[model samples]
Target chain A: MSAVRVWSKPARVVLVVAGVGLGACVLAFLGALFLHVAPANSVSKQYRAQVDWVVYPEFEQNWKLFAPDPLQRNVAVDARVQTVGPDGTVVTGEWRGLSAEDWAAIRHDPAPSHLDQNLLRRAWDFYESTHGEGDAQAAPGSRGQLAERYLERIALQRTGTGGGRVIQVQLRATVTAVAPPAWSREQVDTAPHVRELPWWPVQDADREGLS
Target chain B: MTTPAAVRAALPRLLTTLAPYQAAVVRIGTAGTWGAYLLREWGNRRVLYGDRSPWSAELNDRLLADTHAFTALSWSDGRWWFEAVYLLALLSAGAVALGWRTRASTVLFALTVLSLQNRNVFLGDGGDNLVHLMAIYLVFTRCGAVWSLDARRRARRPGRDPAEWGEPRALADALAAMLHNCAMLVIAVQVVLVYATAGWYKVQGARWQDGTAVFYPLELDYFTPWPELSGLLGGSLLVTFALTYGTVAMQVGFPFSLAARRLKNVLLAVMVVEHLAIALLLGLPFFSLAMVSADAVFLPTALLLRLGGLLAVQGRAAGWWVARRSGRTGGAAAGEPVEAVAGGPVEAAGEPVGGADG
Candidate 1:
């Protein structure tokens, strides 16, 4: 007299069918995840075409969780917006701190979400990894294009409305040197290096509501 | 009996026989872990997933479409709708944590997590992926079979034969049991894979090979929460090198060590200590907690029960002392025999009050 005996035959059938269906789904999902994270061997690549979609957005992950080497430099993202004045004069704003906002969000909080902790830094990393420090055009479908789009949205969100239509946007990464250990009396260069990108014309797609 | 149809019939029975109480433990661990994460990140929900995100709805929609990831956020058009979904996700997570209607709640919980994580995919780390996978797998497991409201409801049924409740052999019960066993195995394997990959990757890096990798992170401003402590630890090259190599060895040995019970227990203890250190030193408590919860699946049920027994014995002794101090006529409260409370076998004391299975 099992618990399943309490249910009618039809009910048992329905439960079994649903359970099998769910199990299949889980197996497929896990398979896709495995393929996505598997080492880049020929076998893995063969399955990539079939399972790439399953890996995207959700299951796609980077295993560099404090591995190899931890972040040695503290990088901050900064933005400057060029606006038109009432007299139709071009006005350049000061370097507004974008990463500072992230820091502020999590300053007093004990447990900050991964977004507050890594979003801005990863966004900058994304851009840097795709497009090096140069005025190279972002190739279509490349991660560079995606990174540009992501940064553009962040710049627009930070700038906000009410300011005269922003004509141009400039993004930069400020990398500060971390202090060396006391034992190592190494005189490492402590200067901050600023890598600035060319000002891109603000397109309608860059605007929040317009997009 | 050797035919395919007979094999199919036998498969369910095999699975039922093989099913252990481990799935219930994994369920509670995962549910508790994710529940805590949701609560911790509740205040920052807007920044991470809501309208306040730098990644706008249109951008999120495009990403979702391109990635073909399904999320409720894409369907949500307004701020209020998003907020409503977030609230529902929180409540559903609470329900799953309590193991109320666990099967349905597990499904809902996974969906909500997927929706939120997909909405802002960049706001995640390794722990998020583990949590995501575990939530989905838990849906296929018999998570509500033990230590759950559903279990209590089954026990309290009016007019049921008590013996029938102990060993359920029906088709649906067998299937559920099979699924639970399979899912628990998958979860254990998943954790092992994560560690193996992480360990192997570290072995390839020059800095890690040379043992200087740990020192660099401690020196970094981003990870140096306590500068004095980091400095003190990083000052010693021997200590840094030992820690670096020790971590690598433990992680690489974990999968193989699982075959030996004593070695596995020792490694598990070491791993827990390592994770605790990471949580405190690196300020990544949530991630560490998630990993530790996943690792808890390896703990043996017998060991957990013994620990529980020790605690019970201590509690009864304290109770006896309290009774003596009060100068009560009867040494035992409620007319219960003192020996019954003090000298009963662990099994005869009551139902097993522990979690996990080796």
Candidate 2:
């Protein structure tokens, strides 16, 4: 059988076409990644706040994946706000310490408290009634929004000095997970160096100083 | 008829016969897969376009700024006009498939497709990127030479040398093959890394061993298209345990399967299902597509050539008819061998070769 030879012109054209297709896919992939970087008000937004700050000084490590969930993945975080006032006041506050067993569970499973039956046992029935079963994963930010609108019932209040006002702030923060074991103690210490919180309009100066 | 002598004598001829078949299969498989992908993408391009952030709105975004490599294209404009450009690319790809002015069309198609794919890699639902990569490799091959309009035209021409149409004579077939081989390698490596990473993460968790961990993924409401199924599967402690352990095993085992064909295909099928399930349940369309396309490398070239044969048969028939009809007048076509003419009606070797044999 006779064979037909392919010439340079057609070859060049095919390569050009293939190159274009590849280029387009590449662009699309990058665009999607860019979208992930934008702040979103979606339910996923709550996962963002769990990340107090992304560390890595010279190199910003984009953690592609972590144990549990990508969003719930723990980075070696170092968050140091002015725990007191802007006046450099030394501070002491109530910090919830996780027991060894609780610490282990938190490290492995970072599912939202609303979902876990045992974690939010005290308010399980109330939570089940108000929210759907396993809705604890709604995330802190979204939960805060919902709580503000509907659940105005603050179960606790704090009375400090100065103006002597009781701050009815809801406590939703919990130790969801720990940094990966691959992150050594020393590495975690030096890795995420937190800076002082910048001056913003302090919504509640007393709350900021205390909480 | 010693075994060694027979094997040595037959090897070259065997390889020679196989090359065309292999090339043909590659053309066919590529055409089908790429054709399907292009059609789907084009059909959904409108939705994709609607989903995109307007180019004007995100001109100064940090991601775009960081991609200084595209500075020459002056992409620093309003919005990243992803959808508009992608539509143009799909049209170019169709033209390439038709083999209309094949060389130019293929190049244009590749560029446009690659650019669009790169622009929105994240949003891709299925194996579109892999298909794009395959298309790129196909462009460098003799794919358009056989099943394309280019082949039809060339076949019609009176006396063009067959050697001229051979891909390497013009485009260096070996280099093209090497590029394809490299792509396959990259794909394999990437798959290995993904599985390895996932397995590593899973093994770290306590529930992976206890079998309780499966419920978490199953219970992910976002992906609970059929909550009952998740409930059933999630409640099954044994299935979850097996899944955790098996996932890591399969990932680490994939690279080893490449050594043999049967094992490779089996592993590849498993990989495909894994990705398919991810796409169906997790709504991770992009990852699924990229992974599936990568799996195409495991597909043997022989199958591809067979598919190409099916695609090119009509062209082949038309070509043969033209050859037979033209042979009556042309005496001898440019590449017709001496033996072929000798075997023709002119029994006498002394007769002059006319236009039909020219």
Candidate 3:
């Protein structure tokens, strides 16, 4: 029996086209790979907060970007915190907006400013990473909490070098009740939906202003 | 007593009994190969290019600072090995695509794609995940027959009549067919759910029904492309009403439209336009891409073929006269070669029963 050659003129044309498609696929893959390896940022990506510590009751209702319905479009939660220096000095701060840009500085490198500005975001991120999302913010007695607290304790060691009197304080702002497109709510609300919770869940005593 | 008529009826039964499995083998093999190709391509990207690009650099920095960068896998070094499993799985998929040692390749492709997708659930877009999920189902069905090396070898094997295809075992075929059917169901249900939920939400507000909601997105400076397009659309109450009602009607009527090609095409076109508009107006590129790709899922096989044909045309082929002539009859009656059926069986299978058709 003779071997039936499947190749025809049209087939050759198809082969060339497919080859081009395959080449395009390769090019895209390479481009993606370059993006993966390059020392740039996921800036184009919208912000998705995986909070380890919410400091407020309303934060629970805040969108869980880590959850199944990640894009719930809730109120922005802007936060600032002040801490005492190793020598027991205090610091004060004002309520700064928590735009993604501000978070980017802290979330990018999280080391000294020279390394990258993503310090606070990186710390929270590290906590979430080391401890699972559920365990990262555990109560102090729990092993998860103990492990986390120790990590924080270690992290605090690097804070005092920045100032004569080092203090770490946080001011938190929680946006509330963002309305969704009437048609998009069900897709957005597969997770437990929160209806209009108070914006500031923290009482005056809970906040450290200047003292 | 088994009459001739009863025997004739039995032919269909026998054919169907075997055909389901055969069809599944075809689907799984092809899907696996395609999936593998996709996986290799995607895996290579994650491995080789994880850090150089702006997005990856930013993401890497964020993951590193967040301590989410490293994982337990061998490929977690932010290098080629970072998602080695995804790459290996993709390579397995390519082998499955080629129909070489198919049963093993198909199974590997399924598991590998599943694991890889599951591993980085957070970073995935809807299209990426949907493609993987669909691939799993496709691989279970045998898809490699026409385009694969396996078919070539099977044709040459003696005593294994080419008419009686040497496909995967019977049980594998059944399982694959079952998986494909289930995947179809899942995709349909997902679309229905999205529509129903959106419809229900629309009922919650007067604005949605009143057409105000249509203008809301456009009014937002980010989404209105040719601010003039938004103005034109918004100025007309009819357009807004149609847009709002159209979304609700599409969702509520999707289940009904499944069997009707005309309705499905109309609905799909609306969805594509809506997504395209969103992509232009809002900087939600990922969302637009995901939504548009998801919309693509509804496209029938014939349409995909047409698209392939259109794309195949080169610069000269795209001339106005060429396009008009090609567009006139839409290649339906074109005496094009049967080779366009890329995944069909070899000539041995294509031969007509009476041999007159060939």
Index of the highest-TM-score prediction: 1
Per-residue C-alpha lDDT of model 3 across residues B168-266, encoded as one tens digit per residue:
332233233333334444434444444454455555556666555665655432233355565676666667678777766775576578789898888
Better of 1 and 2 by DockQ: 1
Candidate with the larger TM-score of 1 and 3: 1
Q: How many backbone clashes does candidate 2 have?
A: 85
| lDDT tens digits by residue: candidate 2, B118-233 | 44322332245345545555454444434444454444564444344446443443334334433333334444444555555556666555445544555433334454555676
Model 2 misplaced stretches (Cα beyond 4 Å): A1-211, B1-61, B69-83, B93-110, B113-214, B284-290, B301-358
> Fnat of each prediction?
0.44, 0.06, 0.00
TM-score of each model, in listed order: 0.79, 0.45, 0.47
Regions of candidate 1 where Cα sits further than 4 Å from its true position = A1-38, A50-58, A100-109, A135-143, A159-165, A176-191, A203-211, B1-14, B17-21, B158-169, B306-358
How much does each candidate deviate at the interface, measured as C-alpha RMSD after superposition?
Answer: 4.9, 14.8, 16.0
Ranking by TM-score: 1, 3, 2
lDDT of each: 0.69, 0.41, 0.41
Interface RMSD of 2: 14.8
Taking all chains together, the TM-score of candidate 3 against the true structure is: 0.47
Give the DockQ of candidate 2: 0.05
What docking grade does candidate 3 earn? incorrect
Could you report the DockQ of all the candidates, in the order they appear?
Answer: 0.34, 0.05, 0.04
